[model samples]
Target: MRHVDELADRARALLTPGSRRVLGIAGPPGAGKSTLAAAVVDALGGQAALVLMDGFHLADAELRRLGRADRKGAPDTFDAYGYGALLARLRAPRHGETVYAPSFERELEQPLAGALPVPPDVPLVVTEGNYLLLDEEPWSSAVRPLLDEVWWVAVDDTVRVERLVARHVRFGRTEAEARAWVLRSDEANARRAAPGRDRADVVVDLDSGRVTPSAAPA
Candidate 1:
């Protein structure tokens, strides 16, 4: 996606030293997670770089070996511990340091190592994914200590499904496959994600681009 002019300004206003702020963008499978994250970074214009949770997807072979291929994108399917560790590093960045992070390959359906680099200079690191606000073990334990703030992007169920279908189609899934995937897999993920909205520091309504602030979930 192209740069987001608005998010850039917001990111700039939030930057500072002492703590590397991580803005967690959590939503259902096809809620434009990557697009919004990219737009936020593009808005930052080099002031920030992304550390996507997708990069931690278990390798396809690992998933198959674990017999969890059918649950890909589920909260349990990722290396949640590893993702949390990386965020910890980003928060207390050491000068002159460079860290390598993983990236997921959609066509290959696998995760590649050393795909993202977080130099010490970037003050803000925007990490987007489906489970940032999940309050369960391992996954729940991973992010809270690392984030300065968390923003939940809220899109209507109908539009989100449409967006997911379009995305799967763009990625070469058949119409039938896309719709089925959205209904079965993504919708399940969405349900799991719903409880997180109450935990957000800021909730964004993508349909209207309106933001409502709320106290962090108890």
Candidate 2:
């Protein structure tokens, strides 16, 4: 709770009164980015809103079309251009208008359109997902620039792996299948996204219960 309180204050400071400030949280699967994002948004109450990057995940049908079903959480399996466009709108929303952002339905394993309403005066918008800081193609060129600050979230490998396995099991996979996917798909994606932390404005390491500044990229 103290950590969330401190994080909320850090996020609140990004507000400039009249414009929306975008704060992004990125991490490997099961690192608790969503949980942290929700806590920060709750701590800020009406001053902020949440827009998950997972909302831009390519639908399962689309993933199948692209032959990327096995790599569902990878960077290429998202609508990066659409996410960038959404951020652009959120950053400079029309006066007196509310912009609707999509939200992911984990239970349904799909995205819900126009699921979150971001009022023009919300001031702070917190978005969390896996590749917000990835240094790759559309993600690097389109999404990163739109974020005012990107926070990298992480926990120990063992904990993350266990959590992910449980999450997958809860979401319908068998225990053995869950472990396999986490090791094969999730860990690989995490390794690729890991280096992006060097460019982060802040890093939240949950296992250590610490939120610290990222070591600047060389």
Candidate 3:
């Protein structure tokens, strides 16, 4: 595993004295994007902040209205345009004032607006999500342009799947339901996100904790 200190150093290098820079961590479900992002922020102390794409998740009512409740984790289930707008705002903050961002509440499965505040003095903002590197419309157009660098978190498929199942169970699903959800929902999103690995500036193998540069996309 690449040490958290190493990740912090790389993140630090992206900062400018008076400007904000966004570093993105992208990966499939259970690839440890959140964990790694937290570690990097912790290592950077108060100089860094985190903004999560999961916060833009469409509410359950909205999902049900769209007939997409069963496909909740899929890209279309989020407010891609809104997320992109938030990134834009973060990049060009007004009057060096503190900016607030929304956060997702896992237990409630809803987004709470203005749940996180990114202070103006913080030069580095670390954002993590499954679709940060996705090449699809709206998302590709909106997200990629704002990020200074995006690292893909890679892990063994089996380990990733096991972690997904365990996470579902911990969040209130029965063992059988958790396994089913992993296979039926999370796995589909994983496959959808896999191709983005080719577009990453770096790839972090969570299984071995090693970070490597990926060949530029063809």
TM-score per candidate, in order?
A: 0.92, 0.96, 0.97
Which of 1 and 3 is the better model by TM-score? Answer: 3
For model 3, the stretches where C-alpha displacement exceeds 4 angstroms are none
Full-model lDDT for every candidate: 0.81, 0.91, 0.92
Model 2's lDDT to the true fold?
Answer: 0.91
Model 1 lDDT, residue 110, Cα = 80
- On lDDT, who's better, 1 or 2? 2
Q: What is the lDDT of residue 22 in candidate 3?
A: 97
lDDT of 2 by residue, 1-218 (tens): 44998899899999996677899999888889999999999999999999999899899999999999998888888999999999998988788899999999988889899999999888899999889889888999899999999999978989999999999899999999999999999999889888888889998989778999877852
Candidate 3 contains a number of clashing pairs equal to: 3
Badly placed stretches (over 4 Å) of model 2 are none
Q: Predictions ranked by lDDT, top down?
A: 3, 2, 1
lDDT of 3 by residue, 1-218 (tens): 36888888889999898789999999999999999999999899999999999999999999999999998999999999999999999998767599999999988989999998999888889999999989998889999999999999999999999998888888899999999988999999999999999999999987787888778952
Relative to the true structure, candidate 3 reaches a TM of: 0.97
For 1-218, candidate 1 gives per-residue lDDT tens digits of 33256656666767876657787887777777788888788767777888889899988788899998887888888999999999998888898998887888877778889998988888889999889989898877777667777778877888888988987898899999989988988788889878888888877777777777777653
lDDT of 1 at 209: 78
lDDT, residue 214, model 2:
71
lDDT of 3 at 11: 92
Candidate 2 residue 171 C-alpha distance from true site, Å: 1.2
